[model samples]
Target: MAPTTLVLNAGSSSIKFALYRAGDDVSLALRYKGKLDHHAGDVHFRITDAAGRELTAPDAHGHADDPTSALLERLEPLLGDDDIVEVGHRVVHGGPDFVEPVQVDDAILRRLDALSPLAPLHQQIGLAAIRTIMRTRPALRQIACFDTAFHHDMPPVYRNFALPDLGADIRRYGFHGLSFAYIASRLDAHQRRTVVAHLGSGASVCALLDGRSINTSMSFTPLDGLMMATRSGAIDPALVLYLQRTREMCIEAVENLLYHRSGLLGVSGSSADMRTLIGERNAGARQAVAQFCARAAEHMASMMTALRGCDAIVFTGGIGENSPEIRASICDHLAWLGLRLDPVLNASGAGVITCDRSEIVARVIETNEELVIAREVRRLTQSRH
Candidate 1:
């Protein structure tokens, strides 16, 4: 039978699963991709084969309360022993220790549970999914893939908080590692010391040096760094304190505003979706785009400090890959650094959409994080005794 690896990305309200087959020469390629969305109107799931051909049409269940269980139940009919061999899980926070893929066990589960506070939305869901899997199959070969692993190479100078090391914590550990790592691994073939703009609704940048993470835009948590769809991005903690002192606002409320109600949507008073905002060109829409471009360039400068300079700037994610307007706006500010986005190529969906002669190159490239996770699962599972 062909070897198969299953990769799971467990989010707060969704669980995305992908099955990949490790080819005869050990090349990992996706076989099936699907997702289960919960807490919505109705629990719905759909799966597609490697070619994205629908393997199963949309299936619905009326108000499935548990997302993990909902995902598991819907997935049961679609998978069999011949379909899945090993599993890879996306764990958001690895704290200070788990910087590499490791076999999941009791100690790892305990640590993941403890780190739930660091990534309240993601980690809890990851643990919940892991628990559900454990209950469903007690002896499955599973591995924990760390989102912080790629940033583990950051120097002490870059990682430290400068305020007395507090119990090996309070240090900066970047997120979106699996996505960033997939990009970083492929960057060397494209350019040296490249800056990757992962501009989704939730966005961040990673500066790659020689195919390793030198610096990244996001710091400590996803809420820090650049302006996102809803995240405030690198706001002054003093503002929260002031709100608490002057208005008696609680921590949860402040967090909710900063993490959920701010950014493009907050300022736009319209929508977080960039394409929608860009279309309207309203005062709020213009402001949101301007703020996004400004903050992106600002953080790019910081990441450059780690690499002295960059050879290229690669754009990925939903907005980064599709929105030519945002790409143009960002490149406008980067002109001083010699980045000139080729208008014809940028609009045409060409992969390397940068002016050939431009010194600081800019291009768009779609990322495949599930394939990366599948590779890790294959590697770890193959090593098992």
Candidate 2:
């Protein structure tokens, strides 16, 4: 039996884990995959082995109220008697300094700590999970697989802000690096320069050239690109100032509104789930889809400008990969821009979702960020030998 790599992506209320075996291909054929969900209330953890058989069912974690503590306490049983060699974490924001997958140590922890304020809600949970697991097993080797690392190759124009370089360190640190990287590796052979749409609650667009990220819609943070399910993406700073002055809204309050309040949910006054909105025949949902289409069209245009005109467009994530109506609407808006869709191909669930003979290509591709992090974890662990 090969040593296994444990990859974790800890969220505010959930922790997802995937176990992989070490092999010549580095993809440690899958050992198990599972998640502990609803930790803030009734906790449930489930795991399944390589052939998708349930190794463990949704076991209850009846513990104290604290999620982190409860999680650590419950994880003890699942981890014992395991031959896991190293752990890799899906860290949300590594900032500029961590431009690649890195083995976490005291210095790395400090740096991840410093960047927490930029992504207070997401990064801290990942860091806390790392610390919790470390304390549980002090000898375990740990690695931080960044969500921003893949975008580090973007040029200065895409990475920098117009503000003076002194305080501009807080500019254009794209999230979803692993998501985008997975998409880039699988573009259709015909795609030259392409646009990738990662449409979920936390969504953003990226332009790729020869499989490297040339420019992306997200800037400085995930909050700055296309309008997302609940996030107010690409808002003017002046509007933020206006809210501050008129409403007496503090920075934190404004941040919450931008990061958690203003997207399809804000516009539709409906649920954030795109499927829910699409099924209901209400004015709000209609209006929400309209606004979403408009914003996505605008962002796609912006990406085209950045890429000097892309040869293809790919969609991924919850909304991008599944919502056929949303995809059709978005492509309808872009028809004037030369992206013709083949309805047959688009509906067949083929890996290629675009229409025939379209000038600019479009398709739906599955993204596997956890798998990417697993690969990196395995690489770093092997190098330790």
What's the residue-level lDDT of 255 in candidate 2?
Answer: 86
Give lDDT per model, in order.
0.80, 0.79
Candidate 1 wrongly placed segments (more than 4 Å): 23-26, 56-58, 70-81
Clashes of each: 0, 6
- All models, RMSD in angstroms: 2.1, 2.5
- The prediction achieving the highest lDDT against the true structure is 1
Compared with the true structure, the alpha-carbon lDDT of candidate 1 equals 0.80
Which lDDT tens digits does candidate 2 get at residues 23-132?
Answer: 86555687677777773458776777778787654456564244445544554455546566778899999887887789888888998999887776688889887887
For model 2, the run of ten residues with the poorest summed lDDT: 63-72
Which residue pairs come into collision in candidate 2?
Answer: 21-28, 171-220, 172-219, 172-220, 341-355, 342-355
- Our tally of clashes for model 1 stands at 0
Model 1: ten consecutive residues of lowest lDDT? 74-83
